[model samples]
Target chain A: DVKVTQSSRYLVKRTGEKVFLECVQDMDHENMFWYRQDPGLGLRLIYFSYDVKMKEKGDIPEGYSVSREKKERFSLILESASTNQTSMYLCASSLTGSIEQFFGPGTRLTVL
Target chain B: SQQGEEDPQALSIQEGENATMNCSYKTSINNLQWYRQNSGRGLVHLILIRSNEREKHSGRLRVTLDTSKKSSSLLITASRAADTASYFCATDRGGYQKVTFGTGTKLQVIP
Candidate 1:
């Protein structure tokens, strides 16, 4: 089975703090994504990386940014965390041209 | 902007009963995918139907796509409690590696 692991299952941070969420995939997939799921809003893509050092902004990328320095690792960064930034963040990865994405367990971040 | 919209935001059914969810998209797509998410967890891909295909099946799950109508439907036969989850429909637009997800339909199977 494909394994995707997140650095933290839960996190708490104060306003204006910088927060980082990490994701790693064992499948060597070429595509990786970051999403934040809100109630009634489903899962909204924050950012995605097609390959190492390549990044693209998704629909809701204003408050978030991402990094993919290596193929297996993807990281989401919050420049200045706010209470509104609290949400369940998910990381997913898929092979090139594949529609099925394997996802990590998710990190529930609380910005207080 | 969101591309897909799923109908019947929430559903409840008795075990063994069939459950169906509908998704409608706004633009052209290369493919449509169904994903299931257990409470407080990540999503699991259930099925994917290419734009050219009309229908596909995997075990007890059946998926139908109507590209002309920009819509799709997913049906689960002999539903079990384990099938309880939030189902989401995602659309993959041809290039730029863009994919959009719908709000989702929450299904509850009573055993």
Candidate 2:
């Protein structure tokens, strides 16, 4: 069984604050992704990393960035949080050639 | 941009009944996968059907894909109370190493 863990299940921050969400996967997957799920928008990809120090912008990457300093850890950073950035953040990882992804418990962020 | 869109934003069915959901995509895909997400939780992989295959089954879940129409359907047989959750369809567009997910259909099973 693969385990994906997030640093926080729930987080709250004020506007213009810097926020960091961390994700760790035990499966040693090569691909990692970050997404924000909204009510009607579904899951919008924020960023994805295929390897350490490598990141690609997803459909909705504005105001967000990512870091993959280590193979097992990925982090999502909000330069300056805004109310519009508040949403459920989900982290997922998959192998290089495998399309099946394992997701970590989401972090529901509230930007006041 | 979301690659897939699921039909019927919400569905309600009685326990022991069957529930079906549909998903439509815009482009060619290497594979389509279904995921179940409990409220406020991460998604769990349900099944994956490759483009070369038309139908696939796992336990009580049956997934069908139509490449010509770029559509897919998921059928849950003998639905149970624990089956109440949101179902999402994801599409992998080959080498991107990531998939795009649909809005999801929220299913509620009445006991």
Candidate 3:
């Protein structure tokens, strides 16, 4: 079975603290994406990487960054945790030229 | 930013009834896909219909795509309580491997 594992299922952080949410996929997919899901807003893409060391900003890339140093691992970074930044973060991986994407369970982050 | 909007933000139905949700997108797409998310879990891809295809089915799930109207719909036949979840429509614009997701329709199947 294809699997995508996240570093944490829940996290709490203080304001101004740095946060890291890690995702690893066993599928060895070429494309990785990071998204923040909020109520009514849906899943807003933060960043995506099609290849190692390459990243593209999505519609809601502000306040967030991503790192894909390896094929199976993709990490999302929050430079400064703010109350507004608290949301469910999801990571997904898909093969190149494929329409289907496998998503991780997700990390619910809380900024206090 | 969301590219698609699903109509009827919430829907309630009996276990044996069918549930249908519609999605309308702004731009032309290479393909459209439907996904289901149970509660706080991540989305699971239900079906994918390319721009050239009109209707497609997988098991009890049927998806229809109309490129002319830039819209799509998903129908779940004889939905059970296990089918209760938020359904979303995602559009792939072809390049960059990026797809935009809609707000999603919250479905409730009461037994």
TM-score of chain B taken alone, every candidate: 0.97, 0.98, 0.98
Show where candidate 2 strays beyond 4 Å. none
Candidate 1 local lDDT, B8-110, one digit each (tens): 8999999999999999999899999999999999999999999999999999999999988999999999999999999999999767556789999999999
The positional error of residue A57 in candidate 2, measured at the CA in angstroms, is: 0.6
Best by DockQ: 2
lDDT of 3 at B86: 98
- CA lDDT, every prediction? 0.94, 0.96, 0.94
Error of 2 at B25 (Å): 0.6
Q: Write the per-residue lDDT of candidate 3 for residues B2-108, one digit (tens) a residue.
A: 79999889999999999999999999999999999999999999999999999999999999999999999999999999999999999988997799999999999
B1-111, model 2: which lDDT tens digit per residue? Answer: 889999989999999999999999999999999999999999999999999999999999999999999999999999999999999999988875789999999999999
RMSD in Å for candidate 1, one decimal?
0.9
- Residue A111, model 1: lDDT of 97
- List the candidate 1 regions with Cα displacement exceeding 4 Å: none
TM, every model: 0.98, 0.99, 0.99
Report the Cα interface RMSD of each model, rounded to 1 decimal: 1.2, 0.8, 0.8
Model 2 TM-score?
0.99
